[model samples]
Target: MSASVPRLLVVGGNGFLGSAICRLAVGKGWDVSSMSSSGKPYATPAGHTPAWAPRVKWHAASAFSPDSYSTLIGESTAVVHTLGILLEDVGYKQSVKSGDVFGLVKSFASSLSGGDGNPLKSEEERKRGYEGMNKDSALTVLDTLISTTPPTSTQTRPFVYISAADAFRPVVPRRYIETKRQAEIEIMRKCDEHPEAGVRPTFIRPGLMYHPHIRPLTTLPAFLVDLSAKLSTASGLPNPFASKSPLHGALESLRTYPLHVDHVAAAVLKCIEEGRGGVVEVPEMRDWAGLGSKKKAEVGLQGQ
Candidate 1:
């Protein structure tokens, strides 16, 4: 990596994934500014208050409110948006909406129909709905980022969106896949609109992320996926693991390819440095495996 660090702004920086990216960028000597809603207290994962926090200029803004994010984008070389929702709960609603009425309605309907409420058989249908809601969020943020900060002639400011790879496949739930795809579309549109500004939008899809400290219960899904894949391979059935019962199965191909959060952050940094703008799908476990193997081989060669 080059020592010439760029100024970067990370939206939702105090959150789990956002914080990871912030730490990596700071380590790389990049001038990083992290923004979160006002009164939203933030602490580093290590339990230490960020030294830069006092000087880094934290902004109080909501992802849904472009006006709130306007001032934060000034003179930034790159912006990363990592806002998302997993399940519809109270906290999730606060992050994405004011209430979970819509989510509750869908969940109740799905339960009544025994998971067959949606007539759309394909995963695309489900994804469409998911994207419908999330696109608004992406657009709102993009609109502010672009309008407030115009890039200089020499600067090619890139916008990075943290998405999921499920959109590429038909196996994942339509809601999850569709929302990510929609967000990607909005990102592309923003990039297209500001070609002169050199605003390049990149999408990063990470599968089944789990940190070393991630709770055991959180890994249950992945464990079941590994088991199913093994069983399917042994059963001599083509895709014996065809079912989407395990979240890990969707990302099993990446088991040996695990990528740490830091690695993903580094990749984002690389993209900014090289001005390489495109979709980068990173499966946590699988990317890490590949990296580890490569390192081991390099070490062995050095021993020789």
Candidate 2:
């Protein structure tokens, strides 16, 4: 795995988490490229790329269309799929903004009932749904990797999927986490079927990743999560994350453990360097970043 200088292809590299991974990858002196719908980081100045963007190749491409990135996959030794959705539609945020308890209850009911995601670039919906965005999009990358890499290749290149913990099970649509799991399962299945393929799977299941400077709104909630972690250590509870807590139904976001996005990016880099494969959880990520139980910083927050 460490035989050659690593070349990384980050799918959705311009998004909130994607950019962080790309930044860390670039910092490692790795040859990095990012494929985002916009072809560049968000909020780029007119006719000017960000300073960090120069070292990286940014492709404005669609996740469903492999043609947009097949050539890149052939050149890349590793790939990271960061594209996914958390809700089928405007679920909890809308209800919370209006303080509509009835609406909130109705949203929960609709989530329980389950529904389809937005269509892929459906001119009507103009967005991809869970099936397309979460599962199929990663498959698109896997299929492209299989097609582009040679069967005689001996080295293993890691494919990292940015997945979610089941923290939103209480409030969000069930399909949100389900699609994530399916993506991981299917990616592994494909690699198993094609043992000679260049891709190896690593799934990152982070819960409520917060960037205080980049996403100020998540600052307060992240502080709460860290405090809970400190409490869990002192109290000797099995875990402090409210993923299974009864009150999760009321305040899911705050109660869930919050991992910092920077730590997550660092962990991804470590996983690839160590040639590690398998599903990695939130606490493990902090440990991988050498943060362990005392993860605290008054830092600030987003995309590649």
Top-scoring candidate (TM-score): 2
lDDT of each: 0.60, 0.75
Candidate 2 TM-score to native: 0.78
Give the per-residue lDDT digits (tens) of candidate 1, residues 1-304: 1245688888777766777777777776778887776525356444667664543546777666666667767667788887665432223333222234555455534433443235653644433334423565666777776676465566667888887755223233445655677778868977797777667888877655544442222244446554554565456544345435454445444332334555666677777777777887554324443542222335458647
**Which regions of candidate 1 are displaced past 4 Å?**
1-4, 39-41, 44-56, 91-133, 167-173, 214-258, 283-304
Clashes of 1: 20
Separate clash counts for every candidate: 20, 6
Query: Which runs of model 2 end up more than 4 angstroms from their true locations?
Result: 42-49, 90-127, 150-152, 238-256, 293-304
lDDT of 2 by residue, 1-304 (tens): 6566798989988767888888888888899999988896643313345567778888888877888878888888888999886655545545543445677677667656654443344643433567777888889888988777652468887889998877665566666777888888888899899887767899998888777656555677678777765665666444444555655533434434688889888888888999889998877887777776644443553221
TM-score of 1: 0.67
TM-score for each predicted model, relative to the true structure: 0.67, 0.78
